[model samples]
Target: MRILVTGVTGRLGQLVARRLLESGHELIGIDRRPWDDAPAGIEMHSVDLRKRAAEDVFRKSHPQVVVHMATVTHLIERSEERYRINLGGTRVVFENARACGAEHVIFVGRHTYYGAAADSPLYHKEEEPPMAMTAFPELADLVAADLYACTALWRYPELCTTVLRMVYTLGPTGQGTLATFIRGPHVPTVLGFDPLFHFMHEEDVAAAICLSIERRIRGVYNVSGPQPVPLSVLIRATGRTQVPLPELLFRAALGRFGLPRLPPGALTHIKFPIVVDSAAFRAATGFQHQIDEAGAMGEYRDAFPAL
Candidate 1:
């Protein structure tokens, strides 16, 4: 199959691109960032997803499968730019997919859209509406992007649209929200709160995406791996010292003492857990994680030693 992948320069995107290439699929990549070392045989295009040049890639390649993983996930960027890239980029991807006559369109999303709260269910189902807009306003654009991709299912009945709300990924790159939070010597935690953290190895995440494409699964599904563990256990496994602080102090201490700067809304995530049920995805694609929780944490720790 001919596959066109957006954000092919990102860590997860690279993994998925390589996986597809090994499986004998012709790949076309689009990303604003330059992939100087991109493996041979991939037709690379450097362009923002929202721009007109991105549509030209679709018209020329005419890929049968489209994997959208180009949304911004970090908070460092200005909110306006983030919204334009995340939401606007996604809208354009779906529009192009439909216009170019793509068969399958998969939107890779995060499970954190469910929002962590004291009242949140232990395991979130795909049918539940996203609550991050209120609990974590920083993620509003991501939620909107996911919702927009989901709408394509009904809006364009001919397209096979799959919205995958995947769990946090831990791997050698140390490039995800969990990695950033635990980067410093001391990992911060809200006092009296030990929320469960759901995560999987980066390789497993790539395999899940490949499975979704191969099976042509449609609709929304939560993609996860292994069992969930407490936040404290994760910190310990990564060789970081856990620092418990009062909610008030936790907010104040961010961006100080070698910690990464985070928005005020992120505290809710540190205090509560957002776990999702992946039975739907498993049933659809028979996807199982290749690396266990301990292996994933060990690989990350080995890659980035404790400071």
Candidate 2:
């Protein structure tokens, strides 16, 4: 099969492209900017999807499966920019896939689209309703528009589309709250309690995308690790000493810095457990994580020896 991946430079997309190549598929990788560092032999298109004719570029490649991993990420705070690129880029990708007669479309979605509350549920099935966007105003702005674009693709049954609502995908290349916590000056464990978090290894996420492409499964599926680990356990695995920050002191310091105090919603998230039910995806495919939590941490540690 010939596969084309957008966001080929992102951590997840790059890994997926590598796995697809290993599985004997030819790849056409596209990103807004060229990656001189991308693995050799990947046929790359350096055009910006927002400004250029994305459909024409894709038509020339004529890939069988279109794995759409590109998005305006969370750290990009400008909502208007996110709306233009994340939401707009997805619409363009899906429409282009249909026009180009691609067999399938696989999307990487966020679990936060479910809700950030830790006690919300152990796992969210694909059939469950998305967290009320009105209430989660902040996250809603980033994910809701993209979710709509996802639903639009499903209306065409001829296009086999799968939305992989993924958890905090982490490995060495990951950055964000989890990465900050992992590469902390000292490991900080929850003093009172910890929320349940599930992580997908970069390689496993890549493998899941390949599995979906090969199997041609359509529908939303949860992509996550088999085991759900507590934040305390993750801190210990990093071989760093834990400094228990009292909730009061933590809030006070954040306040002094003029940072928003951890809202009850965010705090509850770290104290309770939330798991991703990956059984459906696992049952459909034989692949599982090549690295567990400890192994993943070891890999991250090795990648940055100073840490």
Predicted model with the maximum lDDT: 1
What TM-score would every model get versus the actual structure? 0.99, 0.86
Alpha-carbon RMSD, candidate 1: 0.8
Model 2 accuracy (lDDT, Cα): 0.69
- Candidate 1 residues lying further than 4 Å off, grouped into runs, are none
lDDT of 1 by residue, 99-148 (tens): 89999999999999999999999999999988987978899999999999
What RMSD, rounded to one decimal, does every model reach? 0.8, 3.2
Worst 10 residues of 1 by lDDT: 72-81
Candidate 2 is scored at a TM of: 0.86
How far does residue 108 in candidate 1 sit from its true spot (Å)? 0.3
Q: What is candidate 1's TM-score against the reference? A: 0.99
Error of model 1, residue 80, in angstroms: 0.7
Give the runs in model 2 whose Cα sits over 4 Å from its true position.
Answer: 76-78, 132-136, 175-177, 187-191, 241-268, 305-307
